[model samples]
Target: MKAYILQKDSQSLDNLCLIERPDPVPGPGQLLVRMRAASINYRDQAIVTGGYFGGRVKRDTIPLSDGAGEVVAVGPGVSRFKVGDRVAGTFFLGWVDGPPVGRRTARGAPADGVLAELVVLDEIDAVALPPHLSFEEGACLPCAGLTAWHAVVEACRVRPGDTVLIQGTGGVSLFALQFARASGARVIGISSSDEKLERARRLGLETGINYRRTPEWGDEVQKLTGGRGVDHVIEVGGAGTLARSMQALAFGGRIALIGVLSGHQGDTNPHPLVMKGGSMHGVVVGNRAMFERMNRAIEINGIRPVIDRVFPFAEARAAYEYQQSGALFGKVVIAI
Candidate 1:
């Protein structure tokens, strides 16, 4: 089996090495997955540079939380999956249903991830891929897809006539655009690049705001909605954009805080949220149940994840580089 492991010394791509290892085997309630594809996320870059939640890697680790493949074997007591089933791993290892509890370990950083030819997953920690999706598309669902679903569908309960404001044209934002559009919501997106904004419009974005051109885009959003503001804001840009998000939020609107792409520190006031009677929910990637529900939605809506590029398995490091290059409009995948 071939796997890429990030060494503990440098905590950068310089330390990421591809090596041969014995094929992983399934244990009790586990499934042996033959990984066909994996996707890079912003967090993967954070983890590689020692910027993730738990800081630097404590040991050599397989990096990446999102992957999809076929189940080649199932261990004793495993009932959720069978051989030949296509599946994707959940971001949080133990979050199968309900509220998250206990120590949460996500792949590609603290835990061994699916950036290998073969990997082991708890049956409870995996969900069957939607039938219509290929492995490369399915590989995207575990992180970005589920986070968008959790925000737009579960947290905001987006419905027809609702207005959704997504921060960028990145993976999660694009998925949120699709989900909100599927739910009959009008989607508005903001990006620094006009070309990306144009692409998002083609993806059902009702309006596009180039934040660079319209630095006070929140005010622009309110104007677009005739001063009513938006029902939901997919707030991915941490402190740098939270104040503007609050400004764009409608009365009783909900903002799902999913990332801190723009520096984590700032003096954003929360008084506007109180004034607007709005709520902000901090969304982790999501539970397995959420992943399953999102998959069902993907299947019914015929939604396909947007992939910006697919690199060969040997160029996994290049995939990571591309993700950080800021040229991505969607996901960067590794065809394992």
Candidate 2:
């Protein structure tokens, strides 16, 4: 088997390398997966370059939470999957249902990841892929896709006629755009690129706010919504944009604080939440139950994940480089 590892104690991509290793065998309640594809997340880059969870790579780690593969073998006591089933691993290995137990449960960072050509996962920690999606598309679901679903759909409770404001054109933002549109909400997408915003328009975006042009893009959002503000804000920009995201929300609206793209902590007026009676909920990628539920919606709505680029398995490092470039509009995938 071949896998990429972020070598122990080093966080720079300079330390990442590919090596051959013995193929892993599935133990009790596990499945041996022949990986078909994997997608890169911002957190993946953070882990590889020492930007995640205090910028420390504690050990050599396989580094992706989003991947899709075919089950080639199943160990004893596994009933959730069978040989040749197409599946993707959950972001949290042990979270099957309900609320999250802790952040330590995540994959890719502080745990062996799915960047390998072959891997073993507990059967319950993986979910069946949507029938219509290609393996590359399925690979985009576990982290970015699930987080968007958890934030916009489940946490914010988006509904028909409601307005949703999604920040940027990264994986989670694009997925939130699709899911919100599928739910009949009026979708407004924020991006720095006019070209990307136009592309988003073709993807069911009702309106586009170029943050560069309108620095207070949230105010622009208000103007677009006729001063009513938006019902939901898929807030992925952390402190740098949360204040604006807060200003963009309608009275009593909800903000799903999902990412720390602009660093984690900063000063902000609490008046936005206080004055509007709005709520901000911290979002982590969700559990298996949410993953399964999101898959059902993906299947029924015929939603296909927007993959910005695909690199061959041998070009895994380049894929990481592209993700770090901050130029990708959607998910960056590796075809294994």
Candidate 3:
């Protein structure tokens, strides 16, 4: 089997080496997944640069939380999945049906990632991929996709005729836009590029705000909602945008804090949260139960994920570089 290992001694892309390794067999309650594809997330970048967990890794780690594969073999007591089933690994393997314990349960870093030709996953941590999607598309779902589902469906519980404000056209934001739309909610997107906004408009984005032009998008969001504010704000910009996100929410609306793209240090006034009584949910992807339910919805609605590009397995480094560019419209995939 072949796998990419992030060398414990280095933190750059140069440390990510693709090498041959002995094929792994499943243990009790495990399934050996013959990985077909994987996708990159911003967190993966942090892992590659060695900045994710304070830039110090005590041991080598596999890197990537999203992957899809075929079940080639099953270990004893693994009846949940069978050989030949198409499945995707869950982001949080240990957090099966309940709330996550912490980042310790996540795949790809503290745990072995799926950026390899083979992976061993607990049967309970793998979900059957929707029949409507391809391996590459399924590979994009575990992290970015599931996080979006958690924000829209679980945290906010957005309903039809409700308004959702998604920040930027990244993987999570695009998925949130699609999921919200599928639930009959109106979506407003904010991005720095007009070109990206135009692209978002084609994907049923009800309103697009060029944040570079209008720095105070929160005010514009209120104006768009007729001073009532939006029902939900997918806050992916971290502390830098938290203030505006709070300002953009309706009195009883909510914000799902999911990312730190815009830096993690800033001071936000606590007044809006106290006055509006809006909810703030710190989403950490989701549990296996949520993943299963989200797949059912995807299957029923025929929701095809928006994949921006697919790179060959050998070019995984290039794929990661592209994701870091922040210019892509959606998810970047690596087909194994």
How do the predictions measure up, each by TM-score? 0.98, 0.98, 0.97
Count clashing residue pairs per candidate: 1, 0, 0
Query: Model 2, 1-336: lDDT tens per residue?
Result: 999888987667888889899999999999999999999999888787676775777778888888999999999999989998999999988999988766546778777888899989999899999999999999999999999999988899999999999988999999999999999999998898999999999999989988888899888888888899999999989989989988889999999989888897899887978899999888888989999999999999999999999999999989989987868899999999
Worst 10-residue lDDT window for candidate 3 reads: 49-58
Among these predicted structures, which one has the highest lDDT?
Answer: 1
Q: Which regions of candidate 2 fall more than 4 Å away from where they truly are?
A: none
Candidate 3 residue lDDT tens string, 1-336: 999888885578998889899999999999999999999998898888777855645578778889999999999998898999999999986778777765546788778899999999998889999998999999989999999999999989999999999999999999999999998999998998999999999999989999999999999999999999998999999988999998899998899999998886788897897899888999989998999999999999898888999999899899999998878889999999
List the pairs of residues colliding in candidate 1: 64-108
Q: If ranked by lDDT, best first, what sequence of candidates would result?
A: 1, 2, 3
Which lDDT tens digits does candidate 1 get at residues 2-40?
A: 999988844679988999999887999999999999999
lDDT of 3 at 234: 92
